[model samples]
Target: MTSSPLSPYLRDFERLADLETSVHSLLSSHGQEATFHHVKAVAQKAAELAERFSGNVEEVSAAAWLHDISAIIPNRERIAVAQGLRLEVLPEEADFPMIIHQKLSAALAEEAFGVTSQAVLSAISCHTTLKANASKSDHIVFVADKIAWDQAGTPPYLPDLLVALEASIEAASLVYLDYLWEMRARLKVLHPWAKAAREALRADVSKLQTDKSLRF
Candidate 1:
């Protein structure tokens, strides 16, 4: 028996799914199973969250799934690789190479899967660093990466994040940033991206408050 032709949406999803499968094959054996589960969770969360707002669901889904592709590289060497990629590495980023995975993942998404959408690439690239002026797609992936998956034990900020999700993507991101800040503060090791996210989200959210203040 022959299978029926896939609908456009199904075809698209399947094509991306095939790429995902290839990515899985390329993934190193270490922690592959757990990483696969984490990526799927992040993709689902990114898609759902993007749908709640006017984000690019496709971009969010793809980026979220592929955001950690470079994790195949050992975490310890991330800083060395990251430094080699850039001429001037920031002190904080040089100190914490794990953040380099975002850029490496974005590059891998492009080279491996031919991802061209800046929205998608930007989401992948800054998912960790969360550069200033992040688009909705970027913000959605960033928030989903945190709220959907956690390497640490049960995330203590889930309740706060859920509340923020009801409020807005900007709000959810702020909550996540706050969670990161608390974690880093306790560890006494702050990644540059965390600082960038905090400042960017604060600026983004403050605008709403400023507008409300003027209206009242």
Candidate 2:
């Protein structure tokens, strides 16, 4: 019997879509429809934004689909799960361990689905807090997570973020961090990663501005 063979691109796309479907089904079972919707939106948003930046769309999309897989974990028990797995926790995460979903998602992605691409795994890992040394794919998933929210009503931060995005992803990320700082962070409770990201982004923007000034 002759079987039609899938091209590499089609094969990869199908793989990613399949993974997304499984995650969706699992989320539905757990009543995490909002999480499913958010991750789905993030996948679409990553694919869209990747066109402008020449990023790996498939990688970003796959990472987005799996990034929040840990939402299956109950909020109250996330710390215990992480502890059982012997994962290290930051002070803030120890206090509010719900944020440990990032690490859990990465671990689950590999253990459950055999996803071995470091780029996709890295993107999945950092999509939540966005480590200071995050890659381009990481930033895409991170930004998409915030911009392509699940709930009703437009997020206020999206407008200014769109304005900054018109310039560049770096600019948009700065706008995002600025909004985060003004909103919950200023009132207190900024993640250390966010604080570090803000500092690094500010430095990058300042250097760009300086370079522009020198050219003028």
Candidate 3:
């Protein structure tokens, strides 16, 4: 697949460098080196997958770099920032404030960085939990995010987690759903989006199980 025409605009090395510097500054302010490293890994993975998929390499790279821009702010501040930018978000989803970072990122891309393409914005927003009517770009970014290969030092099960994601979207979604359930149980905060994501994956799991039973 040929990359979108927007590729040139995104691949400007100077622009990407500025974005990286901005991200580092934001993370430094929050004293969150872990988050910075995670985003950097995600960006690297996004770039590799974008090249393979012949995606708009520049747009995908930019999206990956800025996907978590709003996460540096406090949870309460995130909501206000998102609202100020006219980003859409659900009230119940407010608990995991970082989730809104995706939307805020798109806004920043447009207002601050002169990015006006919907494809770029969609790719960034859908990197976490996907929304309905996702485009090919969205799917590419989503898969890249799930299969990021920088977890070598993580627990043994982490590799398996990536393997499961690569094997099937249903399997990956089920695993994510289970993980979310455990998080909610332990955190005592039932984020609305988290619940919704679990329910969606649960339905997928049910369908898969039913299909397997029929096959047997």
Candidate with the greatest TM-score versus the true structure: 2
C-alpha RMSD of each candidate structure in angstroms: 8.2, 7.7, 7.8
lDDT of 2 by residue, 108-215 (tens): 677656789999998887776777766788888888887987668998889999998888876777787888788873443567887788889888889988999999
Off by over 4 Å in 1: 1-17, 28-31, 83-88
What lDDT score belongs to each candidate, Candidate 1 first?
A: 0.74, 0.78, 0.63
Task: Compute the lDDT for candidate 2.
Answer: 0.78
What are the per-model numbers of colliding residue pairs?
0, 0, 0
Sorted on TM-score, best first, the list reads 2, 1, 3
lDDT of 1 by residue, 89-204 (tens): 56765666666678877766765577898889989988875767789998899888887675868778888888988888888888877877878757545766668878978886
Worst 10 residues of 1 by lDDT: 4-13
**Clashing pairs in model 1?**
none
TM-score of each: 0.83, 0.86, 0.64
Of the two candidates 2 and 3, the one with more favorable lDDT, higher being better, is 2
Candidate 1: how many backbone clashes?
0
